[model samples]
Target: MDFFDKAGVMAIGSRLRMLSEQLTEEATKIYDLYDVGLKPKWFPVFYLLSHDESKSITQIATEIGHSHPSVSKIVKEMIKEGILSEHKDKIDGRKNNIRLTPKGKEIAIQIEDQYLDVRNAVEEILNQSTYNMWNALQEFEFLLEQKPLLKRVKALKKNREAQHVQIIPYAPKYKTHFKELNEAWITQHFKMEDTDHKSLDHPEDYILDKGGEILVALYNETPVGVCALIKMDHPEYDFELAKMAVAPEAKGKGIGWILGQATLEKAKSLGAKTVYLESNTVLKPAIHLYHKLGFEKVVGYPTPYERCNIQMAKTL
Candidate 1:
């Protein structure tokens, strides 16, 4: 590949000067045909208004990255030429809004055809491939005006950190910790015959095939709660949510709500339209939390599992 020398770069720049002069000459001819003088800078403002009917001058200036005063001056001239009009802001008494007048709309509509003509003329003169590359460069310049990638990453991290209770992607290693927490909850809150049902616990780790996950809540390194999603066999049912138990030590911290939200988000991500959950009548607080998160009563599907006591479904 041949590198562009300093003189070659200047030569290209000098050619662009001649090209811009030719474009302006051709543009003036078209304006005479349309009976209006259209400035190049006005094209952006016209296109913006055409796309979205109403916007404030401040919004326009911010979007196009021009000084508000400069935008105001150009808008004023366009208004005087009967190309645009101003209106008082209804929502806010302090601000003024701008929109294209009928004449402005007509000219803006013509700009589409005029721009095509200008593009074709340049393409014909500069060869088709060179024109395509030059057009791509212009687009790249426009994209450069957007917020940088680093700023977007910083914002995402900030949003993630502020969450009240996090539902991180589940790991298999927390099964024993979760079992311990459930056993403690049963012993402390409700008197059960046996809190040691190994078969009833941790079925997710040994589940069949796809779409199974567990969310465990932690309070200073101690696992406080566990929730699991079991992929359903029937297409109509999508997935079943089960084993939602919080530690007795970690009760009343709204961890259940967080678990519910996490479970729903997971179900949605897996393309599940409906999520069914089962709860025991003894856990009235859990039922209430389910209701708050938009669950509805449904006929309980017969299941041998001890955790599938009462049934509810949340449609995504």
Candidate 2:
């Protein structure tokens, strides 16, 4: 309690673990009272085998959402207690199949009454509460599965650092940095196509002079990212958000996002209503960021760059 008082909400993990252990201890005691001779931990394997399911350790672990070593330990304990036994699997000689022993089957039948009693008791407990603990746990688990705590913390840290970053209009001084950042990412992940060279080599003539705009992200006065709002000469789109890249040293600092957003705003200021982009699927983070910027994938758009396999567009 003192540790929790000091730790506050950060003690959530420890709190959950403590609750799990407390529940498991209660379940163990209940099983002992029933004299079913079944361990609480063995219930998963026991219940499956009770239903006449002969499964390998892997299969049992998978169905029960546990690791193989965990299931193996329970199986071993049950075997020693003469409640379970195993024989070579018919289809797989390398694997052993586990099933309830005659002793185990008798115990399974005896435990049915206890199972019903426990379920009813738990349901009564739930009825007394405002929220269903089972549903709450599943929802919490799904949230974690969608985005783990680690990623959440990392994103927070990155967001804080990005707050110090300033998105600025590209100048002649940042012309070299603009090319280098884009080159670094492109060459590392893909071969630089001719179109890439034409733009990176001469952004002024290739991008800027064509009524397009370039933007740079300055983090503590250092150029770390660049993006271009290329004025599309086509009728379908007004601007192409292209040549976006963040320096490797500045990765996870959110510079790319800021730079891209700035370029989009710049395009909007220039009377552009729709923006387009092309990318390869292998660049998953880039693709995700594009989607985050409200860009939806579109097909039937031709490209001069051979590396372009996917096209996206957004209406401002």
Candidate 3:
């Protein structure tokens, strides 16, 4: 009776192994549908070949975690079947460089599409909270790739019910809630050393004097989000949209998207031909929601911001 191999632990391990094998079989069937290799064993070879025209047998073996002799055998078979071609490496004449032919490249593209389909299939099966895990994982992965100091960690998305979101126009009475919402947003998501309230305030003043309107989203009668639509005097850009924010407490409820839609409808009702917004990219959820709502990417400000900011425009 080994303590390290207790019955309960062993049973759990065995179950996981069986599940892994089942996933592998299912994956093979998917690949077979695309006329590619039934299993992903060939995927590494395809991926390496697609990235570069040629790779040595040793390089392919190292990448795929296989023995050099085993890779040589596979490469030889592929060459015979016209799936791959071998060339003499110029730097080292002794080594053979492996490359995919046109047919092989076509299969590689199909394999890539199949991978995306699998992802979409899984997302469809999960609840919205679980589905948002994909977005969180993508953001964490992107950060890891860009920065050397960060270690990849699982960051599950915070969840809230969409029905819980409350929408309202900006009111002088709720100025305190509006201020707190903006503070909560910048604090929770982005690290702002100092905020220039003057910039936001100046625009709000000008818009309020003219035809600009604001909306604040509330949850439990507490303000959790804000947005505004300003009627522009300039004919070129008729409406300057501003002051979009979602508080940390009310995040992931899809409130921001609701606010965006509200703003768009407000703009349309006011006869605005176009609407525009300025935002930084660190707010990934906001950016994604904006795109999904039919906003297209456009060059706005001349200077590049540290937060990967971009401007979005849409025609009402």
Candidate 4:
């Protein structure tokens, strides 16, 4: 019924295991025909031992990507077959080094030519398939090295949770929250100037009265962050993303991201074609968040605040 095929990506592990078993069985038959006593599972450890004779079990396990217990089992089997021997390191009494025996070395020499032939045969078999299996496998391994699948999966889960934050339009009841959030951030890092005071004192007069919009992010109905899209009197359709702040307690929960996205969305809905932001490089996390939100460093923008030395903008 080809359950593995029906399961598709969900059955990848099981399908790979089946594939490995089939290949190992075929290789075992080939080894029997050639009178080679080596098993497919032992090849990795044996190959490493042949090249570097005194590697510790930990070293072999790390190089082969096998667990310590798995490598220990293979080592025990090889020791029983007289293919390997173990000894304590001369300087480090706690370290045990595995070495290939004289018989193992002799067998390696005998199979040297057959190893190349078998490799060529495998390559030919892979080439007969529709896809380039070797290149695909190499790319897959490289991607895993770059970012492990577990890390990627965890990040996806975190992002999903972050998306749970709700962005709500500013209301009179949340007015104090908007002011306090921005005031806390600004006073902590940089002193508030007259322009900041004007906006914080009366957001409705300075922001909304001038065709601007403010969006607040709430986690469990508690306001955690706020951002304002102030309509700019410029030649291009422009809006400044200002007065953005996430509470200290909610800093790492991606509330800043939620507020930034909501602000941009509000800007776009207002027929804005460009979005600009002013900040200081010292606010590294804020600067990083801006960049992630598609903001790019730009020059020749006037700033009303003394602390703003960095200007970034995005074409909506």
Candidate 5:
């Protein structure tokens, strides 16, 4: 007859809150049974101060994952109850440090056995569950630290927008766009080399005249990315995929992937037997994109650029 019995996953937040209240009530009963004049909520701050007497309010809040206002309220109550004391920090005169009072220390020593019993009872209750809640919580916290929930959501939004972009062949108007985009990216990461200058300054002479092709990506009628496939002079019909760049604001929307795909298709259309690329190890996302496009690493590929430590090629 519990409301949560039918709510299922939709009421997960409520269910967790109800469980927390139930556990707190049980803990309160245990404290009353042992005649310990302490509140269940106050235990976390008190316990931290007991171990580290010189913790500031900010430090306690951070360690316990509680807000400053909430920790401040708990500290105020503890100070009123003579369970905690505060003093100005010697190293930082502006900061106030917290420590357990003499009376609080005495109470902590007296209730050590009771606290152990409480811990054992909680462990026993958790062992009856299908999964370890403590381990799961630790993992959840680690994942949040690695990539926050809001950041993941924003990235998903960017990916959706990126899917709607259109890939188009290079035009006269897009010539400035090609140089600006490539310069913005290159200058942000590394200095532009002579090879970059020659290709970017005159795409027609350096790329088009040499039997190469340039492709541009458009999002909302704005140029967001550009990539070039440069043909080699050898009779083997080899092409180098180079000068790929995406705008900072338009990145992470699959623009790079789209440009890479278009460049590969252009290479194939031009009768290229193999498509090669030179890149640095620092460009992890770019390297991953190349790998996704079936480009495997090769040794001793002659590159005109100084930053070209990684070389990869895909057979057309």
Candidate 6:
């Protein structure tokens, strides 16, 4: 057919808008034929008020899924047309309740037969189609409710950016990123402890020299995440997964997960039987990630950081 028709789902919004306008025009003709003075755009608000009692603008907007300003404008227009009236709420004097006027009630009674006829007509159209349009619309709406288009598009964008992320070995040049990333998150949530300063300030001296391994995740050749596998002396665990941080601006692009999976694989390759980690319950996402990576809660083993309230271990 045309360009928009050829584009199919890519032109869904424009196509749907056009379809809605077409239906509105046809509905207007039907309303005129029945001698009913109702606008298609006003049908949602009008039909709602006709069936229900007085409701505030906010209530109407919420129930009809229309914006507050939209409902307010429609109510004003209907009030001017002598189809609706507003009065102060009895329960809440600060609020106003809107209800159908006498003329609106009479019009509603007059439109009852037209509504039945239109419903049957729409059902006939739907049944004539190969796929029922009404059912498809409802299912598509439910899918959109589950994951809105905004969130879906954002996730796709993040995944595309994450494809540029590369995990590299910690080098002298990445020292600043390693320290800064850890310090930024630590200071934002809790006071930087002496242990934090010791490990972060001298990762090479305190961690690398003691058989620990540090991995840096680079996005577009810039260090954005760092995680260390610190060799532990504990009886139950071999290495402690510590000092993991992603740059604030680089978060939610799957950098942390990339570094995490790489670090775990490296740990497993180093003859490690189990990996340990300490975290607080407040960091829900981090805790969830740790669980997803096969870590389980543990009660024993003390932590040097005061902020750490939970301990976990993963068996390789």
Best by lDDT: 6
Q: Over 4 Å off in model 1, which ranges?
A: 1-164, 186-205, 208-210, 305-309
Candidate 4 lDDT, 1-316, residue by residue in tens: 3897689887877887888999899889988877888998998999889888679999999999999999999999999999999999999999999998999998889888778989899889888989988898899899999999888877786687686689988898889998999999898988989999999899999999999998888887788889998889988538999999888988767778778887898888888899988999999999999999999999886788899899999998
Give the Å error, residue 266, model 1.
0.6
Worst 10-residue stretch by lDDT in candidate 1?
191-200
lDDT of 6 by residue, 1-316 (tens): 4978689887888988999989999999999999988888789999999999889999999999999999999999999999999999998899999999999999999999999999999989988999998889899999999999889988898889988999998999989999999999888888999989899999988999999999999999889899999999988899999999998899889887888899999998889999999998988888988998889999879789899999999999
TM, every model: 0.43, 0.72, 0.46, 0.59, 0.58, 0.79
lDDT of candidate 2 over 168-267, digit per residue (tens): 8888988899888888888898888889899999999999999998888888888888889888878889999999988788888888788778888898
The runs of at least 3 residues in candidate 6 whose Cα sits more than 4 Å from the true structure, single-residue gaps closed, are 1-8, 52-63, 85-99, 187-193, 279-288, 291-300, 306-311
lDDT of 2 at 176: 90
lDDT of 4: 0.89
Positional deviation of residue 79's Cα in model 1 after best superposition, in angstroms: 86
Weakest lDDT window of 10 consecutive positions for candidate 2: 253-262
Error of 1 at 149 (Å): 44
- CA lDDT of each prediction against the hidden true structure: 0.72, 0.89, 0.71, 0.89, 0.88, 0.92
Residue runs of model 3 more than 4 Å from their true location after superposition = 1-160, 187-196, 199-204, 300-308
List model 3 lDDT by residue over 1-316, tens digit each: 3543567643644766776788788778888777775346566676778888888988888987789988887777777767789988899889879999887777777677787888788777555464475576678567767863322121212223556667777778766665666656765766543232532445457556678888878777777888877676554566766667887656756778888888888888888888877678877887898898788887744532344478888887
Q: Is candidate 3 or 6 superior in lDDT?
A: 6
Give me candidate 1's TM-score against the actual structure: 0.43
Q: Where does candidate 5 clash, by residue pair?
A: none
Of 4 and 5, the candidate ahead on TM-score is: 4
Cα-based RMSD of the predictions, in order? 13.9, 4.5, 14.7, 7.1, 7.3, 3.6
Once fitted onto the true fold, the runs of candidate 5 whose alpha carbons sit more than 4 angstroms away are 1-38, 41-155, 235-237
Q: Which ten residues in a row have the lowest lDDT in candidate 6?
A: 1-10
Total clashing residue pairs per candidate?
0, 0, 1, 0, 0, 0
Query: lDDT order of candidates, best first?
Result: 6, 2, 4, 5, 1, 3
Better-scoring candidate (TM-score), 5 or 6:
6
